[model samples]
Target chain A: MFTPLTVALAVAALALAVWCGWAAYRDQPTKDWHFIGMAVVSVLALAQLAVGIVRLAGGEDAAEGTVIFVAYLAAVAACVPVVGLISLTERTKWGSLTVAAGAVVLAVLQARLHEIWGGGGGA
Target chain B: MAPETPPREPRDPGGGPSDSDATARRASNAPARSAGIGKGPGTLLVTLYGIFTVGAASRSAVQLATRFDEAPLAYLLSAAAALVYAFITLSLVRGGERARRAALGCCCVELLGVLTVGTWTLVEPSAFPDATVWSDYGMGYLFIPVILPVTGLLWLRRSRSHGGPAAVGD
Candidate 1:
């Protein structure tokens, strides 16, 4: 895994989380800008997924099992889009809160991905 | 630009929409006529339960498939937790009177599972070589497992009370 990219993804996710959380607290629906923010975060996550896969293809391995690492990568890549769809189903402020929660979960997953790559075993 | 209009006065002391208008709008736009358990805040709860269902199921499945011999008890408990979460998620999304009751029963079972497994793990550390979802009251998953059922039960009660006059008399 690319450490820098992973850290960047985590930071971006955290930023988006805080932004969405504030919007939810204000009882505001998720606006267009929030979708844009989600897109940016999703791009970063996809990039991380690609990089992780490339490293594995080149005979690199995570400290944990390759299957688990790849699973995390796939899950992280899918998280934002899935959450975005769920958010669309909800037009209220709760939609924004759902996105906020998704962002927080993504950030947490990113951290776990980093730990897995750095030889940390099962979380 | 046209001349600026005067700022509108706040509708309520809380600076929100008037209660009647809000209620009327909500009634119109709500997903269900009766505003079943899956509306409004229930959406958020469903999302959360869905996430946990995936988390716990996948974790336990991987563990059982790869190394079940290492900790059968733990993996089995994890699988059980996953099933409970899955049931609750489905029930919440389905959101009828029956579904609400199912979810309530599941939440009660979940709370019992968490408390039982939590105390068991503390009292007999050797029993769980690996952690289950309810182990240590879900300390690994930030205790959301422990808190979720409680929140679910409360929401179920509130939704029941608000269900209708029929529910009130029952």
Candidate 2:
């Protein structure tokens, strides 16, 4: 696992969470720019997903359970896009909060991924 | 999104000739069609439940497939929890008087599951070598399992009393 990518994803996810939470606080829905932010984070997650698969194929970290590792990798990649779609349907402050919640969950998943990768679980 | 379909009129058992006109009046008298249980805060609840459905389902699936023998009870409980979450999520999305009632009932059941599992895990830790989604009242997941059902019940009850139409089999 690339430590830098995991770190970057955690940071980006938390940043997205704060940004979307601010939108909710202001009684605003997720606008286009917010979707863009979500896309950016999702792109990063995709990159992580690819790297994780490659690492798994190369048997870089086999002790942490490959099935669970692959599942988390896939889940992290899918998180933001799914939440973004749901937010698009719900055009309200709650929609913004939904994205915020997704971001937070993604961050937590990122930490879990780190742990699974045997990164010492230091978030 | 298009406005939710206005609830259909209740059918008359006698099949009277004037049933159509009566049904039309009844439909018109019904409250706002958009007051779905899946609207407003219900959206957030649905989102959370959707995430949990995926999370718990996948987690349990992997666990059950890979090592069911290690702790069969815990893995089975996780799978059951995932099913409950998925059902509640669907019921919320399919909002109406019936769906609301169904969701309400499911929420109570969910709350009961969480409490029972939470206490069981505490009182007999050795009984479960692996943790379930409802273990320790969902402490591992920030207690969202316990909180979600209570919130869901409140939301469902609120939607029901707010005159959400009683659509038959909708």
Give TM-scores for every candidate, taking all chains together and pairing residue i with residue i. Answer: 0.87, 0.85
Scoring each candidate complex against the real one, what DockQ results?
0.23, 0.30
Candidate 2 lDDT, tens digit per residue, A11-91? 999999999999877767789899999999999999999998897788677346887888898989999998898788767
Give candidate 1's iRMS in Å, 1 decimal: 6.5
Give the per-residue lDDT of model 1 (tens digit) for B21-129.
Answer: 4454554344333334665567678988999999999999999999999999999999999999999999988666677788999999999999999999999999999
Clashing pairs in 2: none
- Cα lDDT tens digits, model 1, A1-123, are 787888889899999989988987886767899999999999999999999999989998898788889989998999888878877876666677888888989988988898788776442
Q: For candidate 2, lDDT tens digit of each residue in B1-170?
A: 22345533332222323435454445335655424677656778998999999989998998899899999999999999899899999987876566677788889989999999999999999999999999999999999999999988877775554444223111
RMSD of 1: 8.6
